[model samples]
Target: MGNSKLYKGSLSTIILKLLSEADKMYGYEITQKVKELTKGELQITEGALYPALHKLEAEGVLEVEVARVDNRLRKYYKLTEKGKEETVSKLKELQDYIANMQVLFNPKFGLES
Candidate 1:
């Protein structure tokens, strides 16, 4: 469950990064994309995902468009210019964090000495 918690904290960044590349996507699509990319290692739950998306939209990092598809209203999310900037910055931050973790995990290179 430790890995799951890590994914939860970074889920917003993941979703934003995916949308940045894909232009626009809906909730299920975002979840599926993450699953496919991670080969089922990571799964984003609706309970965790939708709230983050709503927050991003409210924070102006995402723009939403509603369209009728097969008699159902589907909301699509796309990044704004601010969102694109944030995506780049967030990705860099996440990369740095991962690198730091790697150092800790690699005994030969870690701060253990």
Candidate 2:
């Protein structure tokens, strides 16, 4: 399995969380932020990122703004009101998942009878 496969399920959540904090971001900015936060361990490819962004926009969770930058149109994404609410839910879910995974993967965690 490739590195991206590990983070495939959490892509939308990650994007949402970032937008919640940053208010707005372009595609490349999102990718770079993720890379910076993860210390280069994870990279979001265009193939994965655009589709996810489009889906969220369709779902009314994200709002898009287009601006001309350096002779090109740059699309920026920000969380809608619904997305802000969803961000809190998704973050709680992610935290619970991490805690569960820790218990399952760590041999010394909750192993005593």
Candidate 3:
């Protein structure tokens, strides 16, 4: 949950994009993958991760599968067909946000002087 505020709004989109790339992933795995991808700069805490996951599940954007692995039950999540479509939309939205932020903060590239 490092810098949680900075990442709060994008959590679901991040999860959806990850599930879109992978066949399935468990909660802990998702956290680790994000840490690895971000070089440990960002951490997804359970408090934030689970609620977003559940919301996506409730929205029919995700499917869950439970399996017993090493004597422990693990819940894996994958994207539904609707989630696949939503991932594209979310990605585009994120990209647009980034571009706008860059222009806003880096005035040399902005239209206004």
Candidate 4:
């Protein structure tokens, strides 16, 4: 992402949100998908992607499958039942956060606080 500070906190949410929509995705696929979805505004690196995946997998929010593709073994990640529930909760949290930021930035929305 161009301004990574703004995206860092939400990286996990972004990944979860994408996996929720896609049945399964590998690390590289997730990176490319984010780039495509954001029209290249966001680019996820191996440095960032794997750690997040590993964390989610460790949490039992994601499960991994290994399969041979061409000559190489690839690992694909899919959300677990817990992950589905987490996705919904995270999405709501992110949406509310964004809306609050928007209203805070645009005074026309009239932030009471």
- Candidate 3 residue 57 C-alpha distance from true site, Å: 0.3
Candidate 3 — which residues are off by over 4 angstroms? 110-113
Query: What tens-digit string does per-residue lDDT give for candidate 1 at 49-100?
Result: 8999999999899999999999999999999999999999999999999878
**Top candidate when judged by TM-score against the true structure:** 4
Which candidate number maximizes lDDT? 3
- For each candidate, the alpha-carbon lDDT, in order, equals 0.90, 0.91, 0.93, 0.92
Ranking the candidates on lDDT from highest down gives 3, 4, 2, 1
TM-score for each predicted model, relative to the true structure = 0.91, 0.90, 0.92, 0.93
Name the candidate, 3 or 4, with the larger TM-score value.
4
Better of 1 and 4 by TM-score: 4
Off by over 4 Å in 1: 1-3, 107-113
Candidate 4, residue 29: CA error in Å? 0.5
For candidate 3, the per-residue lDDT at 75 reads 99
Q: Give the worst 10-residue stretch by lDDT in candidate 4.
A: 104-113
> Which portions of model 4 show Cα errors greater than 4 Å?
1-3, 110-113
lDDT of 4 by residue, 73-93 (tens): 999999999999999999999
**Candidate 1, after superposition: displacement of residue 79 in Å?**
0.1
